[model samples]
Target: MYKILEKEDIAPGEKLYVLDAPDIARKAKPGQFVIIIIDEKGERIPLTIADFNREKGTITIIVQEVGKSTMQLGNIKKGEGILNVVGPLGIPTHIEKYGTVVCVGGGVGIACIYPIARGMKEAGNRVISILGARTKDFIFWEDKIKTVSDEFYITTDDGSSGKKGFVSDQLKDIIDNKEKIDLVMTIGPAIMMKVVSETTRPFNIKTVVSLNSIMVDGTGMCGSCRVEVDGKTKFACVDGPDFDAHKVNFNLLNDRQKVYLKEEKEAHKKCRLEERISGNK
Candidate 1:
């Protein structure tokens, strides 16, 4: 059993869990994720490795309570043990000095991109980060990201914090200002990433994105995480959670993401029902 060493509420409905996984933490790298099961009967959920400390033997995973599996995970507080925690999985980010690189993250995708941005900066790249959310309360890890970034821009639809626009808007501004951006890495909603790809296409800026958000059953045996990249089928679990944004088929990816929405809602309802019953008892 993997024990939870600490838990912090980073944002509403989002919790960061630091787990005691010596082996996994030692081997973990930027852009890899883990498959965790709260209990024996629980379904496996893939969570990106937000951060890891090899010396402390701990790995940090930020969980957003979006569905049954995650909500169940939220209830498992610090000191509790998880039934399974199976990785340092997926391909690590291709980190190298790529001149000025823009790292974009939308909402919870910020957690996934944090480590990547840090690694890029450490590798001698000038990292410019853009973080966006619906409102100010939704944003987290500003200080951490800022520490690794040469320049940082924040955006929100409501203008509650930072600039009042989307991350794509910020990207356009950066490009329009004649900034020499060699590469762009983005992780967020498919729609957001698609927009980012479109924004950079004309400028010929290389963009990398993570498809972990749409993935299910990280073992690749399920084929549920299969996505079309450059008109060819690729599994996110084994092939990559990271891919060139321009070559990715965003239309098919968006469609595949909706495949389980109805079922997911039903599952969340069942979880709520069980919770209420247990509370009453």
Candidate 2:
């Protein structure tokens, strides 16, 4: 059992947990993820590693209560033990001194991008990070990300904080202003990443995106996290959660993401109902 060492609510519907997983923490790298099971009967779910403290033997994961499993995980308090925490899985992001690296993150993707940005900086790259959310309320870890970034920007659809625009818009402005960007890495909603990819494609800049695909098993055996890169099949679990953005088939990725939408909504609704009933009891 993996024990939760600390837990905090970072935003509405979002919770951050620091878990005591020394094995996973020691080997954890930026851009890898873990498959978590809340209990023996709980379904497996993938969450990107937000941060890790090897000395402390802890890893941090940020969870948004989007579906039943996440909501269940959110209710788990500090000191509680989870049934399974299998990983440091997936290919780690290739870190090198890529000159000027721009990191773009949206919503909960900001959590996933934090470690990567820090890694890039440590590797002697000038990291510029752009983070966005629907409104300011959804943004978290701004100070944490800012510390690792040489240049930092934030955007909100509602103009509640930072600039009133999209992260892609901010990125475009930077590119248009003749910034010598060596690489661009983005993680967020598929649509947001797709837009970022499109924004940089014309410049022939190297761009990478992290794919959040469905998975039953962390291994390649499940075939559930398959993605098409440059018209070739690749598994997100083993091959990568990161891929060359210019060669990725975003249309297919977006379509595949919707496959379980209805089921997810139903499950979320059921979970809420169960909570209400239990509260009344």
Worst 10 residues of 1 by lDDT: 212-221
Q: What is the per-residue lDDT of model 1 for residues 1-281, given as tens digits with 9 covering 90 to 100?
A: 99999999998888999999999999999999999988879888889999999999999999899999998888887898999999999999999988999999999999999999999999999999999999999899999999999999999999999999999999999999999999999998899999999999998999998985466578778788999999999999888989999999999998988898999999999999998989931
Which 10 consecutive residues of model 2 have the lowest summed lDDT? 272-281
| lDDT at residue 117 of model 2 (Cα atoms) | 98
What is the TM-score of each predicted model, taking all chains together?
Answer: 0.97, 0.98
For residues 207-276, what per-residue lDDT tens digits would candidate 2 score against the true structure? 9999998888989998989999999999999999999999999999988888899999999888999989
Q: Compared to the true structure, candidate 1 yields what TM-score?
A: 0.97
Q: What's the CA error at residue 104 for candidate 1, in Å?
A: 0.3
Clashes of each: 0, 0
- Candidate 2, residue 48: the lDDT equals 98
